[model samples]
Target: MALTADSPLTELLQENPKAAEILMRFGMGCVGCALASGETIRQAAEGHGIPLPELLEALGIEE
Candidate 1:
C-alpha cells in the first residue's frame, strides 16, 4: 500500500523498513516507540516539529 500522511507509523515501517533511516535522519526516534503503533506519520511530524512535506519527500512518499 502506498504511504500517506494518515499512514500509521507501524504500518509505514512494515511497508518500508528503509523509512526508519529517513525518519531517524529527520530526528524522529519514534520508530521504536510504543506510540508508533497508533501515531500517524502526520502526527509524528507535528510532534517533532518537522514539516510534513519535507518528511514525506524524504520518505519518497508523494503527498
Candidate 2:
C-alpha cells in the first residue's frame, strides 16, 4: 500500500522495513520507539523538524 502523511509509523515499518531506513536517513531514528506505533508520518516529521514534503518525497509517497 502507498504510504501517506497519516500512515502510522508502525504500520509503515510493518508494511515496508525500508521505511525505517528512509526515516533514519532523514534523521528520524525513532522508528523503534513506542511512539512510532501511535505517531503518523506527519506527526513524526513535524516532531523531527523535517519538512513533510521532503520526507514524503524521500519515501516515494505522493503528497
Candidate 3:
C-alpha cells in the first residue's frame, strides 16, 4: 500500500525500509522509539516542524 500522512510510522518503516533514511534525513531519528509504533507520519512531521509536502516528496509520494 502507498504511504500517506496518516500512515503509522511503524507501518511505513516496516513496509519500506528506505523510509528510515528519509525520516533520518528530515531530522527524525526516532524510528526505533516506542512512539513510532503509534505515531502517524503527519504527527511526526508536525511535531518536528517538518513540512508535510516536502516529506511526502522525499518519500516519492505524489501530492
Candidate 4:
C-alpha cells in the first residue's frame, strides 16, 4: 500500500524502515511505542509539534 500522511505509524514503519530514522530525527520516538498501532502519521506529527507537511516530505509520503 502507498504511504500517506493518514497512514498509521505501524503501517508507515512497516512500509519504510527508513521512516523510523526520519521520525526519530524529528524527535518522534513512536517507533516502538504502543500507540504506534493506532496513531496516524498526521496525529503523530501534531502530537510531536512537527509540521505535518515536513514530516510527510521526510517520510516520502503524500499528504
Best by lDDT: 1
Against the true structure, candidate 1 reaches a TM-score of: 0.92
Model 1 Cα lDDT, one tens digit per residue, 1-63: 788999889989899999999999999876798877889999999999999999998988877
User: Could you tell which candidate, 3 or 4, scores higher by lDDT?
Assistant: 3
Off by over 4 Å in 1: none
lDDT of each: 0.90, 0.88, 0.88, 0.85
Candidate 3 per-residue lDDT, tens place, 1-63, comes to 777888888888888899899999999988889887889999999999999999988987654
Q: Pick the candidate with the highest TM-score.
A: 1
Q: How many backbone clashes are present in model 4?
A: 0
- Using all chains and alpha carbons, the TM-scores for the candidates as numbered come to 0.92, 0.90, 0.90, 0.91
lDDT of 2 by residue, 1-63 (tens): 777899889888888888888999999876898877899999999999999999998888887
Model 2 score (lDDT) = 0.88
Candidate 4 overall Cα lDDT vs. reference? 0.85
RMSD to the hidden true structure, all candidates: 0.9, 1.1, 1.1, 0.9
Model 2, position 1, has a per-residue lDDT of 74
How far residue 55's Cα lies from its native spot in candidate 3, in Å, is: 0.3
Regions of model 2 farther than 4 Å from truth? none
State in Å the error of residue 39, model 1: 0.4
Question: What is the C-alpha lDDT profile of model 4 across 9-52, one tens digit per residue?
Answer: 98887878788899999998756878777999999888889999
